[model samples]
Target: MTANATLSPADAVQGQLEAYNAQDLDAFCAFYADDAELGAYGGETHTRGLAAIRERHAKLFADFPQNHARLLHRAVVGAHVVDHEHVTRAPGGEVFEVCAIYSFAGGKIARVDFVK
Candidate 1:
């Protein structure tokens, strides 16, 4: 079994959240599958594949150097993990709440749907 196979669904989600808060693109992407998809809760896909996801977040991290997401709550259901996050673009800057539903496959995140 690979190292990733040992991580629980919630653990994978939490690791990605930590990496995202740190603005570490590679580390953040590490938690996702090669063909991972990112999109709105019930809308169109915003990003497809790991590279696309990385590119999207790279711009975000560059634009908001102090970006951070605080975890308000989290729930794990089978192969899915749902997280409630409060995100800040910068200190005293734009803030928003988001609900992210993460789908896991083979111990890696396969898709993420966001609800704002």
Candidate 2:
């Protein structure tokens, strides 16, 4: 079995969140499936694969080295995990709230929809 096959949905989501806060691209991407999709909650798709996801986050981390996300709430239902987070791009910088819905397949995140 693949490493992801033994990873729980909640574990995958939390792992990615920690990796994101630490700005570890490889570790962050490890939680997602190769063909995972990322998009706005009900709008256009922002990313369509692990490579694209990595590329997008690479720029984000570079631009906001101090970026951090605080988890306000999390819920797991079946293969999906929902998270409400407060994010700051920098100390005393742009702040926003986001709700992320993570869909898992084969124990890895297959898609993520974001409501900002």
Candidate 3:
């Protein structure tokens, strides 16, 4: 747990998702805690900590400007949010649906597990 937490866990995740849709790396990263962890689908944790997360996502955003994630559904239980999303990168690129489970602590996202 951390201090000065102002946004609700769900709200933080929502903001981050919104920022993600806009491809705004800075805004997207703002909702993560300093020591946040992201676990990739069918893989180990690809990134840990805010700086690493930012760099990872920044490269994604820059590499694929047409990348977009559409929130199909969401469920919130306590400090956890599970989001069903449809993601696409460009017209000819891979398009897939994924479920992302987010764990929030101190009003920010502390962990994320992506299921594809």
Candidate 4:
């Protein structure tokens, strides 16, 4: 276990799910730090502000209107949580799984990195 194993931060995974299910990019991105880093789909690492994250999500939603994320597993270790999720396109299409690690500083996520 990492350093966060003892703190056991609150379950923020549900909020993440709700944010994505609702397509609320702002809300979804709210789970990060002011200068958070996101590396989704094993692509180039993005070190940007929250607005950039919002814009990215907006574009994604526009491209895949029926996309949704389902949290499959979650491990809380102090201020860090590793969430494994399955993302589906449309009602029942292809499912892609990714594991995201969230490290929090204070209450906001300082780093978010994931891979398929």
Worst 10 residues of 2 by lDDT: 1-10
Clashing pairs in 2: none
Q: Show where candidate 2 strays beyond 4 Å.
A: 1-3
- Candidates in order have lDDT scores of 0.91, 0.91, 0.86, 0.71
Which sections of candidate 4 miss by over 4 Å?
1-10, 40-44
- Cα distance off (Å), candidate 3, residue 76: 0.2
- lDDT by residue (1-116, candidate 4, tens digit) is 11222233444556656777888777777665577667764577775766677777888888778898888888888777888988997876777998988777756666778888
Task: Give per-model TM-scores.
Answer: 0.95, 0.95, 0.89, 0.78
> How many angstroms is residue 105 displaced in model 2 relative to the true structure, after the best TM-score fit?
1.1
Candidate RMSDs in Å, in order, are 2.2, 2.2, 3.3, 5.4
Clashing pairs in 1: none
Candidate number that wins on lDDT, 2 or 4? 2
Candidate 1 residues 1-116, lDDT tens each?
A: 12266799988888898899888888898998999999999899989999999999999999999999999999999999999999999988999999999998888899999999
Off by over 4 Å in 1: 1-3
